[model samples]
Target: MANLVIASNTKAMKKLDKGTKDKVWAFIEKLSADHTASGLHIEPLNAAVDPRVRTGRVDLHFRAILFKIDDKLGDDPTFIYMGTWPHDEANKLAERSRLRVNPINGVLEGIIGELDGEDDRKKRTVVPDPRGELDRAIKSQPKSYLAERFSLADLTERLGLEPDLAERAYAASDEDTLLDIAANAVGWQGSALLDLATGLHIDTIREKHGFTDSPVDDTLDEDEQILKALEQPASKMQFTFVEDDEELRRVIEGGDFAAWRTFLHPEQRKYVEQNHSGAFRLSGGAGTGKTVVAIHRARSLALSDPTARIVLTTYNKTLAADLKAALLTLDPNAVIADRLGEPGIYVGGIDALGNAALNQAGNIADAAENVLGYRGAELTHNRTSADKVWRDVVQSVSSGLDAKLATPGFLENEYVAVILANKVTTLEQYAKVARPGRGVRLSRPQRIAVWKLVEAYRRQSRMDGSLSFPEILALAAEQLRLRAEANQGFFADHVLVDEAQDLHATHWALLRNLVAEGSNDLFIAEDSHQRIYGQPVVLSRFGIKIVGRARRLTLNYRTTAQNLHFAVSILSGAEYKDLEQGEESTDEYRSARLGPNPRLLECDNAADELDKVADKVREWLGAEVDPATIAVLTRGQTDRTQFVRALGERGVDARALDNNPATVGHVQVLTMHRSKGMEFSRVILAGIDDTHVPSAATLRAVPEEERAEALLRERSLLYVAASRARDELVVTWSGKRSELIHSEAGE
Candidate 1:
């Protein structure tokens, strides 16, 4: 049977008119049923670059290029590229194109024009042209001063480029043109070369692109290779079959070629398609498609086992909603939708899942009254106010321990970061526990004193029916453990976790208990660089081991290069550890698109800053950017209210984000913490002045010994906010600029 596949890169689709798109769909439907249908005018071109290449006439002036699989041409033609081009140009493009399976990840890719210089040199027959300057420089040195001697073949293999292009790159005698060549290189080749040029480690580059030193299978026949290609998921392929008319309409209407819609990076696809013996995790920086992997994994599991019950969850509700929507978009047959919220598959916030599991086990009333300490309807009305309980606990502890020691904030840090974080309940465990990353040392006497204060606080809070978020999670985890001790089976067959960094240790424990330990038990997607929430629990603490099953994504598809550089600079100097205890940073992460630097505005005061913000919002709205696609974020809740009121006063329709809507005519206003897992086309971060950012209250609340961790949290918060902007970032501040902003300027 013939298959109609959309090309991996959909940029060509954006240039078509609605009438032409309709024609393309009609042709696809006919082609799917009968490739030899009359009036289609499909014929092989004599001058095509590759022997298997052919062209189909879309209309009088346009053409679609197709790459047929070996001798199986008529039956399995893959549409790789389509657009309005002159007949000669279309043929040339087809002639130059080459199809090869990437050795690293076993993915089939179509490339236009071999990277070798022979073909290009043929077009421009000027002998010893000025462009040869770069080629000549490399000839003189043979070895680069920045790194070891790399031959053309080595470069081609490492970058997955054709030998000619690699040769042309080596021929470059000047750095400027070589830089330009690196910039123009498409797909992973450009990213790899840029990283190499920027002094990133060779091993790091190889790992990022899924390159390995191990030998690949060189004996597979062409037929065998094509069969393998057919098995690969759409997320990892550049060319895909749209299959149905509804899917084709979605493709044309979605605008820019969305990777989320058509393809997945190899690493992401691996987690989706491959099964694990135990727990597995996918880790990467922002925009690396971690959530995309989690969504696909959920659907994949459901499709593989119809009787399987799957739980897809994340830390926050807004992100969970986003995940659910994306899952539905990927679900063409409604397989996931029909099973969602049922016994087959479930999707929601982790807290929601926890509550559901507790309710199912008939422990909800006791959990509400005892574990969470709520009375009557307060259990329903005041459920999400657990964070406030933690704050109140901090205040009470700070005042109680003030007379014993100068700064008592470390006690709160110890109680949460050490005790509650590790599920430590008894005072003996608290006194002997090793506080990694806490930076404060306490004698046994001091530990006892701190324990006395914390114990009193806990007892009084229990009497008052108060519980912090972490405490609730810990309690929930204990409930699950109790159920398990009674030999109760796990609630679900599989659990997939997104935004895992924001989750507390207790949350992981609850998740660990929700699914039985076996193949495909846990799928975690996390990036510590984007950890705005202060819960940094080691995964192994909850018996969730991912030693050899962890993967990292390096390609950034969301933000522009300039914007990424600025966002990364904001996170400079702070070290973040991943769930596996590995040092994580976005230092080597690169972006495909480049844009103007983010604007950093220094205003006279709050009034002037709000006026400037209004002007920027008005400009973005005028540019046809969707109002909902634009966001205004702040460091504090008070600042969020001020910005929301100011935007409303300026006649801009804006709403504070309690939840991110599917579509909106109003702008979103949110605190930096709330904006963690979301993305926007344009973002305006206001009120980041020195005093407001690391608020005086926050500083005074923490002991001097624990100030470094607190400061890093604030920096991470800013990094999260800045990274949420995909295309443009406008940072405004009044009075003294933040030290963090100054640090960014330095980077």
Candidate 2:
């Protein structure tokens, strides 16, 4: 009997037809049970670097490559599943491919040197390239290639990259060339080359690949010592033993990196498995696996105790729905409760959870009266009603206050950021509280006037019978605090929050109070650049401190390097902050994926733009890209309607995906705001023109002092939409483009 393990870097293995994959798994299972099975037809390869390397028949079309590890102790046998390939390809692969413990770095790796007839692929890759390989080469002089930046000696001696593979990567003058090299590379070599080509620091690469500062050891250098080599930290990321049928099936079904829920990079796994003392914050640019970490953290907690009351939440119900779906995807057996305060996992919007908790306590009106000065207003999650209340209050107080100070934006910001945040119930407390992040300064008189305006807004909201979401959060927080003080159990044993940046101060207070303050009390994921709602949250003020417990993910797994650059450009010139007030940087972030630089389609008018969107979508469909995986995002709902009508007229079925799950046979069209928490293989950011982006009507509504922040939020709105793209991003506009998007190429 032998222990069989699946190699982690099996991109080709994942692409097999489901029928072939099932047979491949069966082949491994049979081989593991009895390596000398007569019908298996496992034959040793004479051309292999390691004599034990062999190919076993998976079927007539495919052969499985396996490495037999002979334990020095004469223990039970062990085997490695290199992957399944066509008969000739498998035989050829066994000849050149060899697993070894890098003499210089100690990391175990596999190299597939120039396979038979690979020169044709070297000349031109089938990968998506807008420009041909020759043009891509011309765009890059030798100085720009990874070879020029890194010496061959460093690649070999330091990183232990196979010499021939290193040379192929060295001559890669363009991203497409690197893509070709990466495609041909096997196992760890493939991932390392792509990361190096993108200009990631060499030392960081060493650390990521499990290389340490210790001097090299010549004692354990044999390739035959496969069992010992598999124990290396590098091998930990690349190989996992196949103990059962389900594990093997899950492995062969999904591609590398695409199966983020299953395959976490070593760095990411550390965060998922590590323990934190108190509240922990994980921040990253878009696509950097912040949400992935959050979901896994929730899973880890639930797996620890299926009965531990755990609540996994995000900014809104739409995002919460996505999180719930992802939670199940990660673990189908996970228990998801339909309501809050349950013993199993409860995934919902943070405010929704708070409202539910308050309702469970059986006195929503009384709770509102205790926190807010009144109980008449009903809690409303509707943003429209909240905005209208702010507008009416501002209009009512316009005569007594300065025009700049009477704006609804300014008033609502003060009420949420200062009044509700600090629990200032009196005029004196409002006058005494500091307003650090607010754009405007207020004197004692101005503070009194602002307090009067907030009072009026509350009174009007009561008369209108509509309480804003933030007010409901305030009520919930006050009630939860009282319960905890009187020795009531927390709402949940653990709480996890994704997209923490968009939460208002009151929301944070409620979340902090929802779970008792202890280890793993709060796990927060946010990208400050994605803050399109409310004021920047200062966590300490809300009694949730993350002083030292913080981690950041720098590698993006979703969008290509090209699309990420385009999305990051939209965030240029805006200063972003973390959960704390410290600055958040997007400078060092890198994506392993590569593709065509973002494309821009400029039109003369909105009507013309809609037609072009349809044509471009048709072009994509003609290329065999899945229609369901393409998204066209608009700046407003009106644009969403026009695109839908235009696509329908052109005979392309398009659905307006408004917080709804995607369906088959239609391309999804969403507003930029609605596109949050959703991603597509191809995305078209429609209506990124000067008028629609900044929303000429929006800026006028913002007060003079707060215009800059409002404009930054507008930029963030587009950033969120653009980053939702996974492979290709296309920008389309009717008139002059928004100044936020610079005219430059990426990747």
Candidate 3:
């Protein structure tokens, strides 16, 4: 006499308001009483509605009843809409219909009823269910005992069936009847039932249950058969190469140039044809297939000698991933593994490779200990005493100067500026100038004063017990020198460096030690034009050949010819003088067209300028450009607060790229220094005025020789900013024009 009670909106049932709960209870009670009166034996219709539906456009409602004698009701828990025609349209349809079930669920139940309506409803068919069939099947075959071991309670709960019904279904005498009950219990049909049949070795049920078997095994072959099947496809490795003897014949035989272009760069193709290598270095621009040629070269070397493993290495993980992807495209069967902290066919990063070499020689630990000890000594009391002796001499020089010129405040200010500028260099030089024999010695008070200033400078720069960048380089060089002197050639088979132009003198010395014999083991690729970092490579001092054997690629493919031309014209160098058009036509590509003509907007103040910038972003969104493509390039993070705040006010999706700890977000407001090697569809170089563009923060401590170089780097950064706009470039300045814009504009 068990009956089911179906509930809707169960999630919100516990949180329903008191009044609504009461009404819902009353409705259920009335339905239950009506069901009993209709000659259906019934228990209480236990129903509940989610409180979330109270505020919803439609209310929670449903109708249910218990039935005896197993009368065919088409589908159980069927939904019916009881509202009269048009007047109730404005009202919640669910509430007005009385049975406030989700329309989608109601429609599904109705469709299922329609599907079942065509069946023979009068014939009360019954079969020996799953449990009886499984028991009999398992008993006849000892090997099939695993089927009988299944937990009946667990299966009943899993299938959401009554215990007796589940047991009867599981123990059916006929496998076909058991399978139908199993499929129905699990709500599976078609491919799912086929999967079940495959797992259980029950394929005969396919014919009995009137289910068609889909041919899914056509593409899937067993691994053992793969080698044997390859015999059928004999010409899979066939390839066509251009005949150098007949250039005209090859042009006549046409195929996709894009695929060929991927393997052969113009210079590399020429080099391969000639088969010559002197002191040549390929200086291909970023994305110019430098890595492709490197892989081809490595593969060619490997082909020449199967035993001679070629080592390929790059500066970082991203480059390593790129190189690995390129190699896989060339030869999918080739074995490629990471060379992290170890030597392999392919290694990565100069630091990693160097460390690997040191580790192999069993000297890394000793070298690290030596360097740490030397650094530690500088912070010791004995070292401080030695440093104080020099400080006293500096005070004597300052105290001897005329009182009018060397007043305490004036001397302090000048010394502080000089210290900040030179840092390590000036301190070492000042010690030489203030040697012990230098006559007019300092008084005790003056000695203490100078020592105070020196200590203050050291503390300010975080140089109390730590090595400077230059000192770290010097120590690393010393270790390499020591190793070289011991005749321990701890060298890599090959060395590859990225950002080569930024390497300092000591770094070049380390590179020299890495490839001591100069046996074509070193590959360096760099552009002097993009040397934005102040540290320039002093190639002459490193004892390397300086022939013009380096490959120079000048084509700018990332940006359109118009943008490229503008960038080269504006940047202060002859390096980018010969600007050429990119491979693809800029006009055809809608995403990479010249956007709004560059504008130099002048504003009354920073606040007014931010408001205008915010308005521009809103207008762009109105025009249907994605917010993700837009970026605001500023001088620094501190200067971008007003602009970012204004954008927020206007409900624009904007973020300060400098402030974002991780590299994410769509709309970015970034500093010029942080915007290198990154691009955007629409770039806005904001705060580009005389005062703001080259602010005191950027120009103050930079040396004279480095100023032009820094400005050139800044120009490169500007180029990077301008080129980021695939479709558009916008330059906004305030007050007086920036030197760069004024020079470029010829004003």
Backbone clashes per model, in order?
A: 21, 0, 15
Candidate 3 has what TM-score? 0.47
lDDT of 1 by residue, 95-187 (tens): 766566655445455655422444332221111222355345446645543326465545644544444456566666554445456656545
Candidate lDDT (C-alpha), each: 0.68, 0.77, 0.41
The TM-scores, one per candidate, come to 0.82, 0.88, 0.47
TM-score computed on alpha carbons, candidate 1:
0.82
Better-scoring candidate (lDDT), 2 or 3: 2
Residue ranges of candidate 2 with Cα displaced over 4 Å: 8-15, 29-43, 70-76, 112-114, 119-151, 168-187, 190-200, 214-233, 253-258, 305-307, 337-343, 361-370, 374-384, 394-399, 460-466
Q: Candidate 3: lDDT over CA atoms?
A: 0.41
Candidate 1 local accuracy as lDDT?
Answer: 0.68
What lDDT does candidate 2 reach at residue 345?
Answer: 91
lDDT of 3 by residue, 1-747 (tens): 112122211111123344544443443344323433332222222221211111111123322211111223432221111111121221222221111111111100100001123331111111224366545543554322224534443333222233444455545544444434433321122212222322332332232222223311235332212212211111011112221213212222222212432324233443333233323355544334445556766655455545443456554444455566666665554545344222334545444444444334444433434433222323211112223423443454443443332333333323322222222233334443332211224445544455455555344333445433333333454456567778876454444554455444545555655545444555565554455553433354455553554544433334543444455445543232101111111111111122234555677777777877877777777887877777888876776666676778878767776523324444677776665545566677788787765564555444443355446556656655665555566677767767666444321
List the RMSD of every prediction in angstroms.
5.4, 5.7, 26.6
